[model samples]
Target: MNTAINVQGGQYWKSDNAKTWALAIAQLVSWGSAYYSFSLLVVPMEQTMGWSRTSTNAALSVGLLVSGLAAYPVGTLIDRGHGRLVMAGGSILATAMLVLWSQAQDLRMLFVVWAGLGVSMAATLYDPVFAVVTRDFPTSFRTKITLITLVAGFASTVFIPLTQGLVSWFGWRGALIALAACNVLICLPIHLSAIKRDAAESRTEEHKTRIKVEARESTRRALRTPTFWALAVCFTAYYATFAALTFHLVPLMVERKVSAGLILVTMAVIGPAQVAARALWFAVGRGVRPAVVGMVVTIAFPVSVVVLLCAGTSPYLLILFALVYGGANGMMTILRGTIVQDVMWTKGYGAVSGLLSMPSNIAKGIAPISAAAIWAIQRDYMPVEAIVLAVSLMSASAFIVAMRFARSHPGEVRERIANVGANNS
Candidate 1:
């Protein structure tokens, strides 16, 4: 029961659990509103503007590219106690960008809006959010991070349907405008109000004290380490395949003759299962090695694909595939954050994970377009599924390799902590 940090006061650390959950709720709503609205609006946009899906999807790619590139610097900024400001500003900017997007009449304007959305993402998304939690609640960060992601998982389900409703009621432009207003009205106020920091921060002093004792390593030096590349490859390969699978899931289900309603319902399973899996993982996580948990999750990628491939004619198989695939996808989201924290201390974490993740996030941003292009060329999902399965297998291999290296790597965790301490100092 350590007291919360108060630089000027003697008050003990009180777990800002309420504030954390509030932040999580705001995160869920904001991300849901921003991301989930796209799919629902895409068709309407295409119909009105006579734009191809490819053209519309390209805007998303641009935004994601920007978001990926901005991840590292944003992480660094968050570590430096700028998270609240970044989150607030980003929320406001996102609202403004959405307003602009609602008014966009051309692809060029849409691209501009999404690009700004990318900057907004850099400012507001999980990296910055996770940075705050990780720095402040190192011991309990696993569960907290898992919970935040779990809650946010519902964003797609909540906002996607809401977007559809808005479009149905008010048309796409109005829906976009309404969503933008939501960003301002709902998200902005919550973020601004809940994310207050003390002027005299004790974590700053803690970080400084910790950093001075740790060895300094350049990013290059860090990258040269086997664990670095291993993790990068692992995340990249998994996410690339995962992204493709998600983008193509509905189409794949349709091809399998699953009913649209069933597919939609099944898709909804991912979010709730994500939360449930995190809760389960938290309940039993102490019993297993984290790397092992990661390995199991990675293994699910290929298994789920195999189930889907086998699901061609069987409804039961498809359901199974959904359960496994969706649950794994949901849980892995938490594991991504946990894995980085488990591998190192807060020192250099923001920079390292952010930089390593850039390419992976780029893959995430582009995977949908790439998958579609492949589908067009091949005229079958088998190729895509096969590739994802292969990549998943490789990623699992990389994770196992990385774990071995991590086990043997000396001083990495300590070094990271020391670096954070120094930076804070």
Candidate 2:
């Protein structure tokens, strides 16, 4: 109650629409408190604790690494009709981690807290939640997922300033206590009440058996496709670049002599940019295949890096960088959430998304410290920027190849979707 995060989703939220509204509200708190707020905590933690950047970022690395490891099992659990248990449990865990993080002054303890946070992320974030929607509300997932991201996109815009203000008023420790309250008070209640109990979780033995068999078969079909692996390669590279840059963006801007206030303004611009892009997609993207939408955004990834590289010390260029980069990432989340069902079968969606994301999450886990190490080499961010630029190019190339592979392998994908349809019939 000490923190006052604007629950903007309440405007149109209705009790009867708990499926969409509850999950959407929970996502805002979950992402704002557990994920987007991390970078803001970094400077305060560093200044107060006197920890080096690499050492500090390694804690996040630990959390993300643990997230990747936990993703598969979490997905499998959600797919089996345990979405309520998985997400609710994750909120509980996240609350505990945030409280522990507030008290964890020791480096090792910070890591332990973050490791727990990693599990919380796997449970509560987009992938697992998308799996829930995909499995439970199969007919309307794209609409639901897009709406959820549109609402949650404001996490950065809201949280960055809010967290900074909390840090100013209560210090980092007190700010964390307030964030923990958001999880327990806001997100936790929603997960327990919003998500209707899925019938699959309580199906008869025969039905359960049938579900398991179908899930396994769907997973197997996906694994046999070259598109799955190519998409993996694409995301693995893109996420690494994405994580490294976000964690380092402020420092990178400072290195380029961007003023502090301008840096904050630029950061603020990104969240709205993301929201605007998703709004555009929502208005026009439903008819477009997810793969084509993905290809267009994948190109934007390299272009974003190029824009930033060309910006130098120009403030207008920095604003442009934020818009392009944020818009691309916003659409990319949509692609990540829906592409599996579009290209493969919706059966075992949770498991398929988990397996597809594992490698990318691993790369995301390692990137911050890896970029920091490169920064350490020259005590300069030039090499680090160059590396991300190269990886963006690599990511785009891999995604294009993934689309090609998906096109060539259509017969198998059709057969898998057909098999799932027959099961439903």
- Best candidate according to lDDT: 2
TM-score of each: 0.88, 0.91
Q: Per-residue CA lDDT of candidate 1, range 269-385, in tens?
A: 766766667677767774576888998888888898898888875667777787888778777877777787676555555666677678888988988888887778868888888
Q: How well does candidate 1 match the true structure in TM-score terms? A: 0.88
lDDT of 2 by residue, 1-425 (tens): 11222233322223334557678878988999988888779999989988887777788888899999998888888777788889999999999999999997779999899999999999999998899887767778898899998888877777878988988999999999999999999888778766656454457788677767766876786788788888888889999999899889999999999899989888888878889999889899889988789888888988888888899888899999999999999999988999888886788888889998788888888898789889989889988889999998888898888888878878978887787677555
Each prediction's whole-model lDDT (CA): 0.77, 0.85
Cα displacement (angstroms), candidate 1, residue 80, comes to: 2.2
Backbone clashes, candidate 2: 0
Instruction: Give each model's clash number.
Output: 11, 0
Largest TM-score belongs to which candidate? 2
Candidate 1, run of 10 with poorest lDDT: 209-218
